[model samples]
Target: MITRRGFMKVLGGGLVSAVALGSYAFGIEPLARLRVARYALTPPGWSPGLKLRLVALADVHACEPWMSARRIASICERANDLGGDVTVLLGDYASGMNLVTRYVHSSEWSKALATLRAPLGVHAIMGNHDWWEDRTAQKSGGGDTFGHRALAGVGIQVYGNRAVRLEKSGFPFWLAGLEDQLALLPGRKWKRAWMGGLDDLDGTLAQVTDEAPVILLAHEPDIFPKVPSRVALTLSGHTHGGQVRFAGHSPVVPSRFGDRYAYGHIVEGDRNLIVSGGLGCSIAPIRFGVPPEIVVVDLG
Candidate 1:
């Protein structure tokens, strides 16, 4: 038998603990931290007459109870606030990996994506996760292949080792998009990666004939070495910038090259690479040192 006074004491403690946890879960204390980075790139071919803002969002391992549509909408709302001329979703948006099937179904993605917008246009590509999760239905081509189609239906252009030029004020800016490198098996390739992982800058740039400043959108930033000197800027986000850095630059990362290239802007030679912190969680549904991100780049 328990005493009434003792029961009250235990109940009070439990209530306090529950309140603390509820606050964390509601983001009142922010269980995760998201940081937005600003970058500037000026290539020799860049048009002096044109200056534009490009917003890049990547690695949204969106699922339920975490990166829900409302949360995703909030992220986009932030991008529009940046006043970007164009918005680019750098892939990994619909990662149907792990046990996420329980939380999200294929049909729900299109609605979640409805929140995104770009004055010029929103462009996209598939990520390694999509490949890993889609193999079960690639050939049958049912709901899985529809991922690309859904994005396309929403006015987002999907590119593979191809370049799209956005013309403004008589100056054209080249935006190059590519497939996931991991999607390439020993016999398969990133299509563009046949040039050399994502690093083959010369091959990527060769497709752009105009002197227009070039911006490469490769999902993984570690490929910075292969980017051509001609490329003034490159955007990637595979590392998620550690997404959970413990101390000085997370000692362990999933990249084959290690954590050396985890996050932030990396400059190789004259070109610059910005690795987004990424949104959503992978492997698990929690983030520590890292928070989801939306990046803004000023071409000025």
Candidate 2:
């Protein structure tokens, strides 16, 4: 019941809408949009008296024009203003995309992050990109990457399969951090199904001497299934909410479990995991539906 001229008009309109949406996704959302995503929960066995507020920044993928040092400083300032008891950097400080005009160096981004302040302290872990981007670490298959050293140089404690005990208002809890699950790429010399991951979940958890509720920091959420109930919470980044989500569904996720561990707070069998959407892009500078976010978790 439609005329040829009408069909042409409708097709033109659809084309225009597609172009507009693409422009917004490529230029506006990834570059300009910033948000704070908050979650409040009492994990099983969490200390009642110890109210801990944690601000998490993750997958920074620092690059020129999109995520510059000035912008990172601004993000840090916003995080500091939140007054979290502690702040955790969830890794991927290096640019992961080829579309960057200039890659923001690790030193520059780490220095900007140095401004982050919390009464307890700022902690960090390395993401897959942090390891893959560092040629030296990749070649050796097992050493501190530039991202790790840069963060350490800026006075941030970089955790590598380690746990630290801390007390808040006399209430004690342990913080465990695991190394990146995909620390080494599959090169010619190491052609295997597993990518030579450096993560040691059991070893890290074993470091906790007491029964204090532990919060685990991991770069990827793929390790969530193995997390024990002893870990009150597991915080991760890496997936970036598929970097382009829609209607609470990501068409593609970097995680081995696909959308199962893609983004937001996930609870399974008394274990809890929070996969941050993160503050930057990977593979390309484009985002839609999922905006850049700094995650804040309140626990008791």
* Predicted structure with the largest TM-score when compared to the true one: 2
What is the C-alpha lDDT profile of model 2 across 4-81, one tens digit per residue? Answer: 999999999999999999999999999898999999999999887889999999999999889999999999999999
Cα RMSD of predicted structure 2: 1.2
Candidate 2 clashing pairs, residues 3+ apart or interchain: none
User: Once model 2 is optimally superposed onto the true structure by TM-score, how far is the C-alpha of residue 47 displaced, in angstroms?
Assistant: 0.9
Question: Which numbered prediction scores highest in lDDT against the true structure?
Answer: 2
- After TM-score superposition, the amount by which residue 98's alpha carbon in candidate 2 deviates from its true location, in angstroms, is 0.6
lDDT of 1: 0.69
Q: For each candidate, what is the lDDT?
A: 0.69, 0.92
Question: lDDT by residue for model 1 over 1-300, one digit each (tens)?
Answer: 889999999999999998775555345312245567888766556678788888988887767666766667777788778888888877776653464544554456656665667767888766666554665433332233455776776666876677878876666888888666665322233223232222234565678987778888888766677677777788887777665576648665768777767887777667788888788767765455666778998885
Return the TM-score for each candidate structure: 0.79, 0.98
TM-score for candidate 2, residues paired by index: 0.98
Error of 2 at 164 (Å): 0.3
